[model samples]
Target: MIHEDSPHRSATPGWLAVRLPVHALWLSLAVLAWFAIAAFAPRFGLLDWRAGLGFMVMTAGPLLLGLAVLVAALALALSLRSRPRGPWWKAALALAIPVIIGASLLQLRATAARVPPIHDVATDVVDPPQFSASTMALRDAAGANPLSPYNVPLGQLPAWQGRVEGAQAIQTHADLIGQHYGRLQPIPTGGRDPAQVYDAIVAAMADIGLRDIRRDPDAGIVEGVARTLAFGFRDDVVVRVRDGRIDLRSASRVGVSDLGYNAARLERLSRAIERRLATP
Candidate 1:
C-alpha cells in the first residue's frame, strides 16, 4: 500500500519540476564573457573592428550561443526527473542572456540584409564628393574602401553582407542603393550661396558630433570623421556646399558593409544642416 507522502514519490511531478539544472549556469556565464570580449574589444582598442566585431562577434558569437542554449535545454530536460529543485531558477535566468544575444544578432543580420552592401554613401551619386588629397592619403594609408564608385579588388574586400564577387558586388550595391535610398539627395540651401552657408555647415557638422572637422571655405568642402560609439569604427564624411546645394558623402574606413550606418548618419547630418540654414 503506497502512502500519499511516500518517500519514493516526488512531491512535485515532472511537469512542475521542469527546471534548468544549476550547472547549466556555467554555459550562460561563458557566453556572457564571450559577448563582453567581442563587443568591448573594438571600443577599448584591444582589437580592430574587423577582427573583434566582424570575426569574433558576428562570426563566433552564434556558435557559442547555440552551444549555451543546447546545454541549458538538455540540462533542463534532465533535471525535470530529479527531485531537488537545485537552484533551477537561477539557471533559467542565466539562459535568458544567450537567447537575448542571439535575438539581437538576428536583428542585426536582418538589418544588414535590408541595406546595400556598400560602405560608401553619397548624396551626389552621379558625381560623389571626392575626398581631399590629405583625406585620401589618410584613407589609402589605412587601406579603406576605395573612393572610386566601383572596381574594388576582390581580395581587398572584407566579408561582404551579400555574396558577390569583384565588379558584381559593387554593381549590386549601387543598384540596391538606388532602389532603397534614392531619397538621399543634396540639401537645398534656400536661395543662399555656398559662402553664406559655409559657417553654418561647419557648425552643423560640429553640432552633429563630427570630430577633427576641417573646413576649406575656398573649396566649399567641410570634412570630418565620425567614430561609432560601440566599435569606434571611423567613417569619413565630406560635405560639399556648392552650386546653392549641400551634398554629403560618408564612407566607412573599413568593411564591405556599413549596415546602413553611413546612410543614417548622413540623414542626421542633412537634418542638422537644414536646421542651421533655417535658423537666423
Candidate 2:
C-alpha cells in the first residue's frame, strides 16, 4: 500500500494527471481547426452560409470552447500540485484559444446589437427603386429576404402600436430607414444627362467590387450582386436614374439582420458614383 507521505505519492491521481493535459492539448487544436472550417467552408461553397455560420461557428464553436476552458482549468489546477509538474504549457495554450475566440464573438455581438435589425436599405425609402423581374426571380429562387413595402400601407404599424400592455411600438422598414439613416438621400444629377449618370453608376459599381453587372440603360436602371469577401453571401444592388436624381437600393439575399452591411454598401457605392460624376 502507498502511504500518504510516500516519495512516489502525487496530489493528482495517476490516470487523471496523465489524461487531463492530453485532453487539453487536443481540445485546443480541435477548436482551432473547427474555426477555420466554419469560416472558409462557406466561402469556397463547401457548405451553405447559413449552416456554416449559424450552426458551426456561432453554436458549436462556443460549446467546444466552453468545454476546452473547463477541461483546461481542471488540468492547470491539478498540475500545480502534481509531484512531477504537469504540462502547464499545454493547459495555458488551451485556455488561450477560448479567450481569443470569446473576445471576437463578444465584439461581433456588440456590433449586431448597435444596429437596427433590418437588411434592406435605400436612398428613397418612399417608393424606393424596384428590382427588375429577372433580378427578383433570382432573389426568389435563392429564398432571399423579401423587400419590405415602402411603408406600412398594409396597416401593420397601427396594429402593432395599438396594444396597451406589453406593446412595443415598432416602425416599418421604411420608417427605420428614415430614423436611422436619414442622411442617405438621393444624389442630384446636377442637370447631367440620365445616360451619363447611368454610365457613371456602372463604373461606380465596378469600382466598388460588384459582380455580374447588368445595366438596362433603356430602363434607366443598373443592377449587380455584391458577394461578401468572407462568406460569399450575396446582396443585390440596384440604381435608378429618374426625376433628375439618382437613387440606390441594396437588399441582402439572406439574413434578417445584415449587421448594417447593406447600408454601408449603399454609402460606399454612392460615394463612388459621386466621385465619378464630379470628375466629368
Candidate 3:
C-alpha cells in the first residue's frame, strides 16, 4: 500500500486537493469578506459608510485579486489533471467566480480614475443654481454631510481631498468643473411658459422620489433632497426657473467621489421634465 516511487499515490491526492477547492477556499473567503464589508457593513452602521466602502474598494479589492490569481493557477492545474473525469469542467468554472467579481470591482476603480474626482455636478456649471436656504439647512442637519453649496472650497475636506489626484487643494470654481462637465444645457422650455416649466420641474423631482419638497414662488427655486434607494445617501437638488431656462444643480451630501451619480440625477430629471412638459 506504500511505495515511495509510485506516481499514482502522489498524483491522486494532489489532484483531489486542487480539483476539490482545498486551495480555492482562500478565494471564497476573501470574496465573502468583501461582500460583508461592502454591503452589510453600511446596514450595521459599524463605521462611516465612506470608510467602509473605501476599505472594500481600495484595500480588500486588491487582496481579492491576489487571492483570485492563486485560485486560478491551482484550479487550472487541477482541471488539466481532472479533464478525463465526467464533470471536471465545473471545478474550473467555479474557481473563476472570484476572479470575475474581483475584476469587476477593479474595473470600477479604473474607470473612476480616468475622470476627475469631484462629486458636485450641475447642468449650469458657471453660476450653477445655488441650493435654497431651506435645502441648505436640511443638508447641514445631522445624518447629512455638512457642505456649503458655494464656499465648500476643495482640498479643505480631509476625507474627500485624500481621494483626489496630487492631493493639492482643489479649486471648486465653475470653470474648473466645466473643464470636465460642461453645462448640461438648460432644458428648453419647449414653448412652455415659465409657470408650466416650474411646475414640471417640481413634478419631475417628486416623480424621481425627492423628499421634503418645497418651492419659493418669488425666487422660482424648487428645493428637495434625493436619497439613494438602498443606503439612503442624500443629494441636494435645486432647480431654478429664470430667463426662460430651467437651470439645475445636484450635489451629494457625503463622500468625495459621487461616481457620476449627481450628473445622472440631473440628466434623469431633465428627461422626465421634457416628457411631462410635452404632455399638454
Candidate number of the best lDDT: 2
What are the per-residue Cα lDDT tens digits for candidate 1 across 214-264?
998777799999988877778999999777788999999987768899999
Q: Write the per-residue lDDT of candidate 3 for residues 1-280, one digit (tens) a residue.
A: 9775555633545556444554465556567666666755565666566666667756666677676667656666665654343234444654666667777777767867755566777777657788777776666774565544444546666556655445335566354456656646687776677777778878898888888788886987888888775345778888887777788888888766677778778888888888889878
Error of 2 at 116 (Å): 1.3
Question: Which candidate wins on TM-score?
Answer: 1
Q: Cα lDDT for residue 93, model 3?
A: 55
Distance (Å) between predicted and true CA of 182, model 1?
A: 1.2
How far residue 177's Cα lies from its native spot in candidate 1, in Å, is 2.7
Better of 2 and 3 by TM-score: 2
TM-scores, all candidates, are 0.83, 0.81, 0.76
Ranking by TM-score, best first?
Answer: 1, 2, 3
Off by over 4 Å in 2: 1-25, 75-90, 153-169
Clash count list over all predictions: 0, 0, 0
Give the Cα error of residue 59 in candidate 1, in Å. Answer: 3.9
User: On residues 154-191, what C-alpha lDDT tens digit does candidate 2 reach at each position?
Assistant: 23533223431231134567777877788788999999
How does candidate 2 fare on TM-score? 0.81
